[model samples]
Target: MATSGGVDVGAAVIDCGSFLIRGGLAGEDSPRALVPSAIGTRSGKNDVLGHSLWGLPELVDQVVDVYDPMAGLQAIPKWDVMKKVVDHVLSKHLMVSSKETPLILVEPSYMWGVNGRAAAAELVFEGMGLKSFFIARGPVMAAFSAGRSTSLVVDVGHQGAFATAVFEGYALEKSKQTSVLGGRALSDYTYQVANEKAGQNGIRARYELPSMSGATTEKESKAEGSNGVVDSTAAVSKDTAGSEEKEKPKDGSQDVEMEVKEEAVPAAPPGEVSKVKPTTVEAPPPAPGAVVPKEGVAKTFSLDSKKAFYRMQIVHDLKQSALSIREIIETPDPEANGGGPAQTATAAAVVAGSKVKREPRPTVYTLPDGTELDMGQEICERIPESLFDPRLLSDSKIPGIESARSLHRLAYEAASACDIDVRRELFGGLVLSGGCSLFPGVAERFQREVAAITPQMFKLRMVSPSLRQDRASAPWVGGSILGSLGTFQQMWMSKQEYDEHGAMGINRKCP
Candidate 1:
């Protein structure tokens, strides 16, 4: 709760992006509910929506079709789904009635031209029946979060990146620049590398099974001895082991060896030949909503759409935990041989020369099947390099990747688009905000790259927050600050104003 004019404001702030929707009360240090910006609908039933499918168990047992309402920071396409999401957050997470709370909605700069602000106003005032609300641009909020009224805010989020120049807390919309490179693109590249490695090493997908009475303890066990009960040893093995013989069950179901702790069996009586053997049973069908297993034999298995989606989640975690950017870009020495290109050097030597220094040890990520992946520096550094050089993504299948400019170029161009008097200030107050910008060494690298292209007379400075969480949710933090200010209490657009002027009134009121 926050106070304005000695009264409890009870304002709510929602910052919804392509990947996540962050919602919380105003004046809070961080968002209370950070859920995925997606809703799941069962196949053939698009009207029925599931709010939080991030939990694995909920996703199992049904073929869910995941849809993202905010895919590219544009105007939301699925207003119905968006409304449900808002309700879920407000009532379920924030425990506040929509009609009682004043809301601040954050939107991107590009959406301002497309009537996105007015549509959002309609959703808040008419759809949700909120009393009052304000629409704030994401870049301006990010600048505010960084404690600057004037800054060049570069936000690299899940779907795309944008560089906006702000002056006195107002975004210079004409000077805004956008790029296709973002956190999801880098995560996709990391997934490619990890998938290839898993294929080569015969790694499988593992999942934690729900606990049942009389279940075995937390130890590696064989799935065969579960006696028709689904246990923690269930695993989905990939078809990586070439030429391995696989047993086919008579029921036409795949037989996968479950990795679970072996149950103790009574010793056979009087040394008679014990006929007990590992029971072979029908494996769980490789279908949508099938539970992932803990371990399995080295055999081929089809990856259902659900499994692929889940694996992407694992890759996303690995990217966040293990990825790092190089402080300095590595390039081959041009004057190695008599001030000429090293044409006589071998290809391996040239590649070695261009390689950035590796970390002392590779990051080890364990898969669900207990296989450790050695995510070396080469993979970690190369994925983020695409942000600096769009050419690195020329071969990638990601749409619009080739059309994107590097982050440095984006910032420089955005500042150059502004007036000459403000260009220096924008350069001096560069701010990095968003999940992608939280990468270690990203700010330093951005500053270096911008300085290389910037004019000699200009001075460049980065005003990024020291805390990672602050940087990732900078816009939401800014909105939280603005909503709690006593001075800002008069700024919200009331329901009466909306009724008189219509949805388009938000532009005049919020802007």
Candidate 2:
């Protein structure tokens, strides 16, 4: 509800990612709604909307096709379905008429040539019948959120990661780089690890259905938790101890995989695994007359597409709650006495050996059904480590896993691709944004890793917001600040302008 020129500037900011869509009024500190960028549909029925599309027990009961419209921050494939999602957010969540409210939409920097910007402009100006609209790139807005007009913005989002060089509020088109190592990739890796451990330790995973009598209201479901989905840890439990054998899916389609195409990058030498003995959590011995589940019991259940989607959500929760970047500190080699060249080689080996001995403490995470997953330090640490070393994913079947570069490499390459005059500024002002970057120690680790490859003359600094919400919704917050400024009123592309020059005209006005 900000005002410009004494007129109410009721502009709304919508920043959509592969996993979530953040929306709110201008001038707000945080987003008012964070809906899933997905929709559910059944033949001859109304489309299921918002959090309900997550296949929550109280929201959806039957099998349905859950389509994610914004996957990998790419161009919209199903414009018809995407239109419904936008309409729902405006009318249901924001509670404003599309015709009256001006809009600022945030897109990825690489989306321009693919007609993503033009299509979005069409959707807002023609499809939604909005009075005014503007399109902003994700990395540029992320820089603005950190109070920097020029910075190297590394956005680690749900589907993919991007490093873009922004100079004076303009993103360098050639300097933008992308990778498949992101939140979803980490979640998939976590899921794979959990499945392997479940097979070995008699653990099980199943969907816990809510009771009809205790179902939450629609309004309650919408506000149940952040990111639209209800809290998975607090979900109802119906699983019990029982004997069952492991069952594998017939088609292997149940395995979680990223939607992007696969590409290959040269693999790095594998690191040595730690030899430290780790403790494992075991279930208590069954009481008299109690049935004890046998070891290696999978208790596999048939999951429809909808249920598979929900299972992925559970894995995502585990990644967010349990996974963290393992801080790697280089230690001086003790064997490096003033000696022959062979001694220096031996010293380097000793340093590498020391890294294998530092293991993180194990953490136990309880599932919705009260099943405890005792994640060993190696697994907990390695999951986030994959972001920094894509070679860790070399064993997995995910497409493009072999081709993905570590985040630091991506940042260095992007900045190097920029003009020589601005490379120093880009390196000095590195901004971390996106939900995946919220992992503890990410900022410190990124800055340290990037500095190792950077020129000695340039000083590097990491700009990360202290609040978790601020980093996760950085792009939306930036748009909110820009939309509410009185001096920025003339920047909006009005309806008349769209009619005069068509959707492509938005590129000139917004840029």
Candidate 3:
């Protein structure tokens, strides 16, 4: 956690996720800071301060297991790390007086089990010395962020994606479900596409660089080199210094030609030579998959040139691919629906029929060492479509359970499991909230898919956070809003109550 220069006595809210942890003072509209949800072990690197480091860019390239505090359906898997994470969030990021102020912890709906809830309570009140606390589900927080009491929250996170139905601030547990696919899966797919392309083009295949920064086009670097930016002073220096210069041509026709002859200076005695100024030329950029050192410490780091393409272009393609594949799956086919000999054939045809509509969008990315990588329409638009269409997945050997669920199916199942009376309300209150939901067309596409399954008579109203950037941290915003309210004060489990009832009291107090 990185501390900002401010202190607030009010309760602080933390929205924890697999990829990022968003937190701030309770009364703020949005979180004060967002950090990667990873903790780094003690290493010799300057980036890893003391025993652990959180959300620093240098730690990403470090040789340590980046520990994710939350995994699978369980929240706060590593108890010690979770304690440190909470302490860091409250004391550093939020800059709050933990022992004096209250705390609001946001978590996934699936993690509301008795054990996880009690452990979180113990960690907050007992472990971190926080005085008061309240545990809120991510979906419920998302609903509150949207200013709605009832909603079906779809969170596309790093570990997995979930669709949870919340009615009047309470989660409908039966209908809450998650799939294996999420932001991490998409990043993996991007890596796969880049590696495959590299192999096909005979380039050394490697993972995409997570970050890089300098030339925007491939031609620009070549042009700079050809224009004599490299060693341009050599020719002029030959004439100026005590060295040989070329003779002028006879056909110059009144042109002044100055040609200097070479002169060797006498060698100096032992240790008598003066050191010439060191050249300040920039070193050539390393190749796509090569290690280079910084600060001349001899500790080198590998660079993956493919990162620019993945971050700028491949991610957008993934969003487009998800939208396209989802539309195909949800669109019903009459022949595939019927039971006949041709039914199987029709279903196969329909599954294979849909194609990604490609538009010409060229992208140019600059590498940190001033090199550029150019991507064409095909390369820029290509992503693993199989995530949404399992048939498109090349590996048939994968177990059915592991590679099965699609986005459309997950949404349908969640909506179907809701009570019949409020099923319409659930459909209409569908809220897309998460890092992945920040993709341009995801919300519109999600609304369209839900509208397809819903009857025309009931209005299908889907909404997202008002600010585009807030979509990723919607739950944090909700926690901030909820914790600030005067009515919410009664919900916090104070230190006095925790002392009397112990950690188990959280299940009853928060409930």
Candidate 4:
């Protein structure tokens, strides 16, 4: 939605993910600005020419690099970096003042505690100086986006994948289970695979750590499988140990931290700018130990874009592998159940012993370096196999997801954990959202696996966004739909209320 610089503009809906930030007006069909949840910077100054520079290598100049504030299960660890990213979204990209416009933000389901939500509210009301705001759970928002009020939301996003059961627009906090095997895990696995391939050919592949370069004095490396060649100009990796450690319930026990209350909370009340901004500013030459690549010096480094493609391939492989683990169950037709012509035909086919013919489907990807890599069915099928049966992978321990559960198990467990009265509804309304859910055959495989384990009395129905639907931005869409509602305005925890109650009141007003 286009908006002129003015006061009291329409409410802005922002879905802040660990990977991407999708935001726009409350009534817009889609987010007008979709940017990477990253901050680009150069030394001596925090000026990142572009607000979103995930894949635009050409637009990049100088010793510029991007850093993700929320790299793991811990979201929004860097308050300053997040502030800059959000400020750019509101002031520059949206072209409206955030201080005036009411805002609705979608947060990850896992980050639903005093620490995450309260800190976010502080950022919005106190930090951004916004008057009104609303916080919605990522999976709940995803369920809303899928046109359902109650659903078992299986969202596979950038940071991780989660199975959250939402009943009547309320998230079943106890039923929410997450896995570390998300986009990052897939990307890291891809890097490992690529590094192994490069090693076999006696080639060196150095992955430019997006967050480590540019602004910092030294490059930090986290390369797996690649030779651990320490650069003299590089600093020790800044990544903290156990960054991916998730606060999961002990022994996979279903425990509800917060009870779902059925009551309406009182409604409180609702960057870059220019292209000539010099992609690379004039600066003094690098210091002796500066990590920035020497000017005019050609370097052979793998781009993040190429690695993203590998992640997609891995996602597809996971879908195929999960599907392969299941045995197809054929149900008898109604006519076949009774003595009829269909039964006669079925008998004949069984007698004939006919076999179904199938062929392997190869996925081909073109790398950024203008090279084509064709992943065979066997290899692609093996990639995602680790998700279901971790024993298949040598390094089964994934960060964040200490105890990885299969997609089928996650959904089934989420559904089973719900109240008996809502179990059928949860099972029937299985909503799949997020980037990995877009992979082909994922929904079908999930349906099959869930059906196999589901009791005979219960039927399994899986819901997924259409091909044309923006699955990755579903949470933002839900926030948009929600923020545009006349009733939704009442739910906002106003600046007046925040002034009186402070951050602790967020749980009461917004919850």
Candidate 1 structure quality by residue, lDDT tens digits, 22-97: 7878888777765555554444322222221432232233334444465443434355557776776665456667
TM-score of 2: 0.74
TM-scores, all models, native as reference: 0.72, 0.74, 0.65, 0.69
User: lDDT at 507 for candidate 1?
Assistant: 93
Question: Candidate 4 regions off by >4 Å?
Answer: 1-9, 49-52, 55-61, 74-76, 199-374, 385-388, 400-402
Instruction: Please report, in order, the local distance difference test score of every candidate based on alpha carbons.
Output: 0.62, 0.62, 0.51, 0.53
Please give the RMSD to the true structure for each candidate, in Å. 14.8, 13.1, 18.1, 14.9
Query: What is candidate 4's lDDT per residue for 1-511, written digit by digit as tens?
Result: 2253553456888887766666678877777665555444434433342221322221123224444456545444455556666676665456677777788888875664776678888988888898888888888888888888998888877666788899988888888787766655654554455434433331111123344224322222221113422221122233522222111100000010111110111111001111211111111111112233322222212234233322333333323222222222344444332322112112221122223334434345333333345544554555455555444444633443456667777777887787878987887777777765544445555565565466654545656566424676778888888887888868999999998998888888766
Extract clashing residue pairs from model 2.
262-400, 263-400, 265-403
Order candidates by TM-score, high to low: 2, 1, 4, 3
- Residue-level lDDT of model 2, residues 1-511, one tens digit each, is 4343355657988886666777778888777665566655544444555544443344454335455554443445345556776675665556667788888888754454536577777887878788889888888888889888899999888767889999999888789898877766776677777756655432332433343223445533443354333332233222411111101000000011111100111111111111210011001111112232222221111224354455665566566556777755545555423222112111232122223444444467665556688888777878788888888778875557878998889999999998778988887788888777877667657766676566655667767566766887888888888888898788989999989988888888877
Q: Candidate 3 — which residues are off by over 4 angstroms?
A: 1-8, 44-63, 73-76, 199-390, 393-403
Worst lDDT run of 10 residues, candidate 3, spans 249-258
Candidate 3 global TM-score: 0.65
Superposed by TM-score, candidate 1 places the C-alpha of residue 380 at a distance from the truth, in angstroms, of 1.3
Q: How accurate is candidate 4 locally (lDDT)?
A: 0.53
Pairs of residues clashing in candidate 3: none
